[model samples]
Target chain A: MAQATLDIPANKIWGGGTSPFGASYGKLMMWFFLLSDAFSFSSLLVALGYARHVHADTWPLVENVFFHFPLTHAHLPLLYVGLMTFILIISSVTMVLAVDAGHTNNKKGVIFWLGLTVVGGLVFLGSQAWEWYTFIVGGEGVVKSIIVDGEVQKVLVQGANLQNNEYGHTLFANFFFFITGFHGFHVFSGVVINAIVLYQATQGVFERRGHYEMVEKAGLYWHFVDLVWVFVFTFFYLL
Target chain B: MNHVEDQSLHYSRPHSRTPEESKAVRKKILVVTGLLSLITVVEILIGVYFSKTHVGEGTWTLIKWFYIILTLVKAGYIVLVFMHLGDENKSLRTTVLLPMVLVIYLIFIALFEGEVLIQYVQEFMK
Candidate 1:
């Protein structure tokens, strides 16, 4: 039998009883890892909230700042963010399906869903890039114009927008790029991990072992990605 | 919930957890999704209302507090139910949640420090 551990009954924790779920060492360690990773993310977001609090009175409207359409003259609020959120939610669903398929030894099902998840992840990253580009390039600003006679001419320099002003001449933008960039890297890495698992599934690797510990581990990671997005959605977009 | 009901069964192909199990899990997912959408709608409403009415500080404060609480609730649900932490051992569960308590403390202190620092800087620039 493949160590089918369940929860440690509630009453037994204080009374020196061995935890039922304690039988699975990998699972317990995964829980610890998730806790630490969650903290690092929370630290970054908390700093963001602190900074936002100090500057809220002058903070540019978030939607207005983030809404410029890529390579177009139109702007719409909550457009890209809604798309990003939808992508993440969809990817989470696909990942759950992959986990389910892995447990069933359904190689084709696992590959299909895992592939879809990778695609979803790539799309989300692309959207984030577009959002970042707009902030960096099309950012709002007014510049002094030099006119000949009746015409006005000037080079527009993005002014004191949130991306340009706060964080010591836009440390906000710097940190935004750095933190979210790091997170996106995690997503990219997760996609690779999923690909490897898909390949293993195709080879019928886990069938011999009779347990899907690999799937459980990957599920922990994929769920963490989804979990991080919830906070990112709240702090970065919703607020 | 019994021995037979919870017994590990080898399954292949489409991966439907027995039909009854499927219904149970689907029900759980749907309920969580419903709560999530409700929270999102509430967020949109609060943002709109604040922009329009310039409501009382008491009301505004309450809304802010509400937003924070709901944010925590949504985060908790995703972790517990979807992440399967709800099925874990007690010690393991605490290991995941206890550090979160410290994060709350850090956020409070950061807010205070940020306010005081901003005030001092403004005075200095004067």
Candidate 2:
């Protein structure tokens, strides 16, 4: 029988009482969670891409689909989505600031930045809700063919749902709802978590604990949300 | 609890950094944000321009590739900086990144299989 080594220092390789990955257990767990989440998102996106490829000729142009801007009837392709992307990215920046503040044990700074992050998340969520509403209640209209009583009839399709959409393929709207809706849910949860963390920061909980690791962990989640949006913007909107 | 007594706790450690360090960190954060925004703007511009003008099929495909590359760049930067992955140990970084190879493989198989199915169906119909 092999004898176990007994003289290894606690901080050395294969030693006990050390963070093997050089990060706290909670943070590493968060990374693993994010990695798994990334797979889920990517699988959805790849499926979307496959659907688009299959329906390439008939698929609605993304720019034409998302052309309408708020308060202006003018067609501004990608303007609103772009603004939403910017808002989310800026929120990620604020989240970083909040994490940095946590590192320095600045209670006021953590509260302020985390508050901004929550607000940014809320704004992005609100924008997504509006976008979904617009999509469901579509603008203009596309003529769709239907068979009625053994005769072909021409009918206009407006708005979107599981069954019908103004866009060319129903799969387009399905993927839109499924992918973005899932991401929007993530943003929603992130905002709620930020709110709780902000409240705790206001109470100086992390200060008392002598670490702001909670903020860092939350920041990782927020940034991952933003990162996923980047791919969504490209695959769903830009391409 | 008194301030002095609070300081005696094991959890108490001075976390305050020099103003210069804080400023530098803030500047780095701003720079990354600027880069992300710039990439978004470029993506939008290319999309709009291509939508307006009739481009060759090859050119359009190239533009799509460009968009994917740019998006990846932005994602990498956000993960590295905002997630603080860049500051982590090499083994930790690898632990996070190594699994991504599987994701890429998944995407490739999905796209390839989808294309083959589409082609088969088209041939059958013809």
Query: Which one is best on lDDT?
Result: 2
Local accuracy of candidate 1 as per-residue lDDT tens digits, A1-239: 79756696554654443444453555567677878888889888988888777766645556556656556777565656666766776787677766666655666777798888878888888988887766666544655353546787663556334434422335456556766776787788777887787678667776655656576677778778877876776676656
- Please provide, for model 2 over A75-158, each residue's C-alpha lDDT reduced to its tens digit, 9 standing for 90 to 100: 899999999999999999999988888787788888999999999999999999999999999977888886678898898888
Model 2 reproduces what portion of true contacts? 0.65
Query: Among these predicted structures, which one has the highest DockQ?
Result: 2
Off by over 4 Å in 2: A1-12, A147-154, B1-14
| TM-score for each predicted model, relative to the true structure | 0.78, 0.92
* Fnat of candidates, each listed: 0.37, 0.65
Evaluate every candidate with DockQ and list the scores: 0.31, 0.48
Worst 10 residues of 2 chain B by lDDT: B4-13
lDDT for residue B121 in candidate 1, whole number 0-100? 82
Candidate 2 per-residue lDDT, tens place, B6-87, comes to 3212222437778898899999999999999999999988887787347887898899889989998998999899898999
Q: Model 1: number of clashes? A: 1
Clashes of 2: 0
The docking quality of candidate 1, as DockQ, is: 0.31
